[model samples]
Target: MDIDLKELNLDELKSLQKQVVKAIGDFEQRKRDEALNAAKAIASEHGYNLEDLMGDGPTKKSKSKAAPKYAHRENPALSWTGRGRKPAWVIEHLESGKSLDELLIK
Candidate 1:
């Protein structure tokens, strides 16, 4: 239902404000209950015990001591070689008159 603010008296405006506040509170409570029920249902179907469901703490980082491979690999493209300042390898190849297009894989 559409209401014109210009047509409502002071009492009607106050009553309308109260009704809107109550509706918002009721909708929020319903949303909370629905989410709780869905989570419980998922836990039951997945065979997770109550403690297992409750213990979903913060995610931990990988503890492997070895550094990842390809950490030392140079970028294939020359896009980020710094503005007008090429890396040593690129300068060497360019000084030898090698075509930039041939150096780029793409």
Candidate 2:
């Protein structure tokens, strides 16, 4: 309420600063908990719990790694998913008048 910051020594000021930071963090956490509780109450009134509404639904699909569809001619270990920009080996293969089908892992 009435803190005379000017009267505080260096250590006291540092301690006060730490206390202020902790207080701010605690206040924010309390606010977030309040909001979450309000949201859960609203969700329950709508015949659903918060978790079901936020569950891993189709809209929250996780990305899976694309299987490599193409490989290096000389080094089979080097591969590409045929998704993003072509790798150097793929570029070189194309530059040599070779088709991407030539690198197919099949």
lDDT of 1 by residue, 17-88 (tens): 999999999999999999988888888898865446687645567965532221112554334323355667
The lDDT of each candidate is 0.66, 0.93
Give the clashing pairs for model 1.
none
Which parts of model 2 have CA positions greater than 4 angstroms off? 56-106
List candidate 1 stretches off by more than 4 Å. 49-52, 55-106
TM-score of 2: 0.52
Question: Considering only N, C-alpha and C atoms within 3 Å, which residue pairs clash in candidate 2?
Answer: none
Top-TM-score structure, candidate number: 2
Alpha-carbon RMSD of each model: 9.5, 9.0
Residue 63: error of model 2 in Å? 14
lDDT of 2 at 38: 99
Question: Which structure among the candidates has the greatest lDDT?
Answer: 2
